[model samples]
Target: MPPMRKWTINGDFLTLSPNGVARYGREVTLAIDDLLAAGGPLADGLEVTLATPVGGHDLPLRHIRTVHVPEFRRPRLPQVWVQLQLPRHVQGGLLSFCNLAPVAVSRQIVCMHDAHTWLMPESYDRMFRLAHRVIMPVLGRRARAVATVSHHARRQLAALGVAREDRIAVAWNGCDHALRWRASRSPRDYRNRRPFVLCIGRNQPYKNMELIWAMAPALAARGVEVLVAGEAGGAGALRHGPNVVALGRISDDELAAAMEAALCFVFPTRIEGFGLPAAEAMARGCPVIASTADALMEVCGDAAIHVDPDDVNGWTAAVIRLLENPFERLAMVAAGRARARLFTWRGVAETWLGLMAAADGVPVQAPGGRGAASAAPIVAGA
Candidate 1:
């Protein structure tokens, strides 16, 4: 049997309250659940001692060694001193974990989700950019093994000079079960309402809502209403159309209903690590028209219509072409559903388990050792 390993997960995301901040909290949650679920010869003696940031819900009270780190703006450095407060093995050290925080122990695994701040600097604040530039690589290079969500991020990490190519693993994010469950449930009857293209996410510069709005009039001219969902901001430039409906901060049920009922799901993001909305829409059986960007292509694969987000006419043409062609729309919806099946938390969890095994020097078994066989397969766009 492989020796039982000890892991210390950095639960920074869990420490923050969900204050309408659309960040990557759920990813941490999924990772925890997956680690626990993937128990066996490798997982039996494996014990996880989570070092969470201060002031949040304490998770799995029995298995956690909660450490209070100051917020990102003010991080406490002496993590070993903090670990001394715990009753368990303080000097045992972390075998592997995610994030790039200062750990007293070595043999760590750090997963940087993406470098969205680097790509879309104007979307984030100055403090965030400064932190990303300074801290992320330090954590990345120091860790024993590094992981990221996409190939795009791997390339970005390489550019940042964090980890060697061989040490880096790509673990893709999963489609939310909320999306899948909602997709399975029948949408509330709203057929009488005008057919509309659905747009999700906050009205941020990176989201490229401005470009989507530019094509709205053309879509409306062809009798397609545009439903805009998510928070609004930045210069107060909200898209207004006779056929436009802005529904802000909807429940998952409503989002699934909207996806099912829409003419199609339209995402015009300029940059992304992984396009969750595109996958969510695809899983919920909706045809997606996404921006022709690295992350979007990685997520949507060939299951979506690629549109140049900056080109108004190209956006209008893609939306219009799908709007008129029922066959093409149906084909995309089917393809999307099939493609979405490839992504799941269970699969991701198993991959993580194997990585942990590899890090332990245990001969990892076949059918799962392949770094990304568990990942959502990338169907490259033409």
Candidate 2:
């Protein structure tokens, strides 16, 4: 009989990149590790370790055990590392949070965040787009279970042509990090007297960075500044109008300061697995103006001023309206904070571990919806 599956997580994403996907892996893993240390009902019979290739990045592994596979340290083709090498090295069940899971592992769980490559093909490299198209469907089909960050993503997963679409279930991401890192003790001492609008995250194609830039001219006319922050592919790459200040890769505290000081937070992304920045901004009590498409609608819900991403006029109008109307902005802030309170790291860890256990053939004792921590229902304010 196949050695009674020992639980292991694919840790390649941790070492390879520190993108949004990798950050999710770290945040959720740490939260789970903390819960396991606390020794709850969910901890029983759960023997999970992070099986990883060697890398420079170090995680706070206080409660998490990690096994280093030395051969995988020097990187080769990532697919080969995952498909062939990882499976050969790791024994027992696998829980892969970042998209791909080894096909050879019969009992495994993979988190399919979104059908991004399908939704925005131009965003990725040619080789990556081709590989994802070929690989994702197979990963979805063969894996014992697939989890997505949002309910909206499950619908997108259906388009991937996976046979077991029924296995696609909701395992949402958390925004507690926003709470932890939010501007504290006087909103980071806002120095700017001018009212500003905030936009965060990288200048990726799907992010619709140009739309944020495009709004600058109109926003400047109304005496509002646009503070664009995040990985702009390196300094000096982005061009903004007279009103825009492109802050590249700011500290969380700085981001929080920006959010707290802003008149409104804008996210005009064409697509997202979950629009984390909007959620992050909401958690900070910043008024948000975000796109209605994909996961943003599910995430922001009634809290934000929703706009069609392609409608430049609509986006401008939303910002203009929010900045001018204090009642609307205050309403968004109150609703947004209440909405953000719904997603917690502790809840995320509980839900994910419950799902992982079920996937690994362990009997799950958690509640039906989104696992144990979800018992505290997300009560959105009116």
Candidate 3:
């Protein structure tokens, strides 16, 4: 029998909020777990365990192995811990997803979600931005491999001097969460008594929140409410325009309900790494009216009515056209569901496995066409 392999996943995200990165980390690990259970690749397979600086007891996975690092427990000292302490504990190759990896850990795969800190600096705090600007370049060059969520992000990373063009790989986000929620009977938290268009709240201008707000009065006149699901605080979430209702801090099931029931899931973000929400919406059979953001284009493909993020008029027209043409909306919903199926955690796990195999000097092929080895897209474009 061949020797068994071992790897450690950076489980710091367990302590953070259930944001996109944490969700990605959890879903990908779970998919890998499922794959291993079925005896996929690496016949002398990995003995994978998640390692964390603090509490990771709440994660659904059974592989968590917590480690104590007093300095790492504090929010402000994360960088210090990663740079100065994490290397000491990584017994084998480390898989550091969600944007930070130990600089000293050469046998590492660092998944940088996006170059957001550079693209949308105003959206983050000064310290956070500064740390990423400093940390990513070093990690990009030092780590054995660097991965990102989208091609746009891979391009931006190179442009921002974070990673060399040849150094990064793409690992797309999966849409299975949407599929799960769609079939589940979880509570539907959104109150959309009227037919509505949905826009998720990101308290930043680049998300083109202003466009959603701007078109509110017109949408209301058409008996269409503009439902904005936002962060916890309703009032502080966004500038509430006419007919806009804020459904704040919802559960996955509720979000799925909103996406499933919405007339059109509208995403007009000016910039994004991988537009997960839009794909999730599409997976739930909702037609989408998305922005021309590069990542949105990649995720939504021809399944969406792609408009200029800044074009309030174009968004308004698309909404009206969809509301008026149920046939077109139905066609779009069908197209979107097909498009959404392309991004799966299974694919990500397969791709990571491919990367791991490559690292071990064993060239392996990933499952889906969207895997790192192929030129296929995360979604089929028109």
Top-scoring candidate (TM-score): 3
Selected candidate, larger TM-score, 2 vs 3? 3
Q: Which structure is stronger by lDDT: 1 or 2?
A: 2
lDDT values of the candidates? 0.65, 0.76, 0.77
Tell me how far the alpha carbon of residue 203 in candidate 2 is from the true structure, in angstroms, after superposition: 3.5
Clashing residue pairs in candidate 2 are: none
Q: Which ten contiguous residues of candidate 3 have the minimum total lDDT? A: 373-382
How many residue pairs in model 2 have overlapping backbones? Answer: 0
The lDDT of model 1 is 0.65
List runs of model 2 lying over 4 Å from the truth: 1-5, 72-77, 182-190, 233-239, 365-382
lDDT of 3 by residue, 1-382 (tens): 7666777787677667766888888788777777676675552467777766655435565543445544544455656766777677776788888898777888989899888788878988889888888888999888888888888888989898888978888888988777777434546544447789987887765776778878887887899988888752277533555577888777777788788778999888888889888888988888988877888877776778888877777788889998999999999899888888789898888888777777777657643546222222222122
Please write out the lDDT profile of model 2 over residues 14-51, one tens digit for every residue: 66665577877878888888988888766776667887
Error of 2 at 58 (Å): 2.5
Model 1 lowest lDDT segment of ten: 369-378
For model 1, residues 116-171, the per-residue Cα lDDT tens digits are 77777888788767766666677666666777767777887777676676677776
Displacement of the residue 319 alpha carbon in candidate 1, Å? 1.5
- What lDDT score goes with residue 74 in model 1? 44
In model 2, where is the ten-residue run with the lowest total lDDT? 373-382
Question: RMSD (Cα, Å) of candidate 2?
Answer: 4.3
